[model samples]
Target: MRRLLGRDHDNRGFGSLQRGTEDAAKGQGDASETKGQSPIRHHGGKEINREQIHQQIGSLSELTITFLLDKPRILTDIQTEYRNVYSLSYLSDREFWTCSFNDNILNLCNLQGEILRSVQTKSKNWPYGIAVTQSGDLVYTDPRDCSINLVSGTQIQTLITLWGWTPLHPCGTSSGDLLVVMESVDNKNTKIVRYSGSTEKQSIQWDEQGKPLYTSLGNTKYLSENRNLDICVTDYAAHAVVVVSAAGKLRFRYTGPPSTLLESFSPLDITSDSLGNILVSDPYNDHIHIIDQDGHFFRYIYNCGLQCPWGLCVDSRDNLFVAENVSGKVKKIQYYK
Candidate 1:
């Protein structure tokens, strides 16, 4: 199969990029709110500012971490004949989901790469982003019709259709809300939209100074909400990991480490672990960058033998699953000791 990220790879251009959403169904876990100034009262009724506590905790110098840089041992590699695998998401600890390029199909597979069920998308449009809601339902975006669809049982239903903006990626948050990366119709404006079902809850487009939070163009911004409730995105166009507070305030942007190994950083998929650590794929360098919740650079997972690692997800146990784009293989790797 051709490398999905090859230089000569077909440029679908702005119109070629896909869209998707995941259900914020009730069940997996509740989303945390770490972006507020509300007072956190203890059992004895002692009032403490939540934001202050997080800042103090984040600044602690004694936070010990064992950086994992050795090659990640591949637990399993699932081979698929699909031309290009664009995304990987965990439906459960035992099973996960993946979507393909130029196709309207989504596969639910077990850890062994055996397809247990295959769900066809609603429209002929290609599915881009995918995520599992707390209730375990699948939600994805169809760029062809500018709609977000939900998969329940064998039925594919269009939950909502967007207008004026194109939704790029959809992620399920811990609070059972859905976060979507959207670009304006003209491709000059980008923002993150939070939704409860079909109702829009919040729109995160600009910083406190009213500057755009993300690059105004491209479809490479993937979304993930950290355990701390901070919104994390691997913005390929911006060449940085843009993180915002739970309340939509711009927190930090990590461009890249000062290393010669990376010539140009094109971060694609991103996910947060149980420890609140952010893991982002650096396929251009064949490695993954791990960072703290506060956007502090932690370490790199190098020599993992990962070739063009694309989609990334962390299972409940923190086991890292990587999709090797060119080889059409999904590798289950253990990165943390």
Candidate 2:
């Protein structure tokens, strides 16, 4: 958000503040000129009062004035500029999948949260977690049914069933396989599973450590294949994102913070951009954390105002869509450049 929305300059409450800074700068300039070349007995303007200097100017200018602060501009008024509904490909160029702990039957809605169509399974299978395959099949985890349903053009078929209802996140992979994060019976432990045509291809977390790694992981729903078909886990518990071989070998980990936060800001869902960056739904922090393909923190993009961000993903056009579970609204974040 450092360029467009990042430039949040409000003239509110900033009156004489501007005049005060300018007056201080002028005083410093005058004192410096009076100090000849030797400047033995002269101390220019009693120093430039570094803290008082950044009263105006943008956040990007902080480093130009001080050596110890690079604070990001805080935010407000968060609403999508435009909204649309896709009857067939509602989530084609979009990512509207979301989850709920209440375990109610979730409906497919437009950006406005209008229920387009919903299928109430035999159980209150909370399909709060969902994803779409590249070939275009809607896969969702039914907490009640404890299964992943593959919804095609008009029919919803069972793809894979899980023993646990809290399958938190289920994502479709580029390789035509499904990556689902399996929550334990207690909803406190989790593991990632790969389903290839209803067959379990791999148990990413279980196989690696003979157990699970996540305490509250959600972003493991989606994944991009590493060079060797390795799998990566966006560890929400450790406050780090990790990568592993499809064979379940530790690859790399990303544990950096974005603009210095007070507490852990983990992701609820993860999706990749054309640039190979990881776009994560950071609900508590109210922003998407963009991680470069190499697993480095890039920058926060949209930070208008968000209410309980539950799910997020990037489309082919590089546009980002977020689903607010609490507000029951879907948002499309258009990228200007």
Candidate 3:
């Protein structure tokens, strides 16, 4: 398989050069896939041509087909007017929800950075995490009150309240379930819990070795459910991205890519694209890491003038909205063609 990034590879004006080949290969692979046939043949040790090689590569998985732009540019910079945008969730392509640190107000803003509406937490406390549901409702976690709250239209309701754990990040899954990352009040235990409404359906905390899957310290862990139903979390204390299967079994952990920056790998926010690619924000390194579902490091997205890129969420069309903590600007970046 061709490597997504190479040491000597130049990043300028390369998208158009590869698009034609990849698109053609994808079409061939899709046709062969529907018929349940292999694109490669073993006929007396025959050598495959370039076209056959492309088809064989494409047959691997559609999720691996990424139409990434050679030079990803920022579509617009939305001056959110917050002290610092700590969390971002897309309610729609034109509207999103943003909240600042230790702030009790959640502002719904358009692409032009106009505050269309605002909602306060049920307890008038800051929300640790925010997410948009499939039904276009807003869900957030209030650690001060140890509850998960839902905002529908003009009403705010407490959906789930914990006894000994404090919810840090709440992610709304496509199946209408919620994935919340919570830590024990004592700060000694951390786990990801799946909730169907207010009821606990599953918990993912221990690995196959009966050890904690995430570090016990740190409130920067954020999560997202991939297109393949895999749960991805960025463990700030652990300095790694931990992924698990839908059954809550540990799959793999990505520490960081090779030739990292001087600062340690400190991942804060996490999200997944429509192609099942995982995107992680590394504020310390001033870039975003794009990895495959199986934990392969593909490339880095840092050229769009990102400064302290903290909160990340992709829109319905896969356009990335990056909330820069220092600049207080929500940059709409088109990473893919």
CA lDDT of each prediction against the hidden true structure: 0.70, 0.47, 0.74
Cand. 2 TM to true fold: 0.62
RMSD of each: 9.7, 21.6, 15.5
Those runs of model 3 whose alpha carbons end farther than 4 Å from true positions after fitting are 1-66
Per-candidate TM-scores read: 0.82, 0.62, 0.81
Clash count list over all predictions: 9, 7, 0
> Between which residue pairs do clashes occur in model 3?
none
For residues 1-337, what per-residue lDDT tens digits would candidate 3 score against the true structure? 1211122222121223134223432443300001111111100111224345446666212424446776788998899878557688877789989997657899999999999999999889777788876667788877766777788899887777677777788887767777889877666788998876666778999999899999875556889888767999988778899999999899999998877654678788898886677899887567898888788887789877787788898876778899977667899999877
> In model 1, which regions exceed 4 Å deviation?
1-11, 14-64, 67-69
Predicted structure with the largest TM-score when compared to the true one: 1
Question: What does candidate 2's lDDT look like per residue over 1-337, in tens digits?
Answer: 0100001211221222223323433443300011101001100011233344445543323332232113332211223221211011125442243333333444555555445555554444434365656554466655444566766666667655555334545555556666666655444556677666676667755435565545442323334443224455555556666666666767667765545763366544556554344666655555666655556665664445554454555555555566554444466665323
Instruction: State the lDDT of candidate 1 residue by residue for 33-133, as single tens digits.
Output: 22211111001111235456457665421231643535567888778656457688786667888887777779998877788888888776678688776
Instruction: Give per-residue lDDT, candidate 1, residue 247.
Output: 96
Query: After best superposition, candidate 3 residue 14: deviation in angstroms?
Result: 41
Is 1 or 2 the stronger prediction by TM-score?
1
User: Which 10-residue window of candidate 2 scores lowest in summed lDDT?
Assistant: 30-39
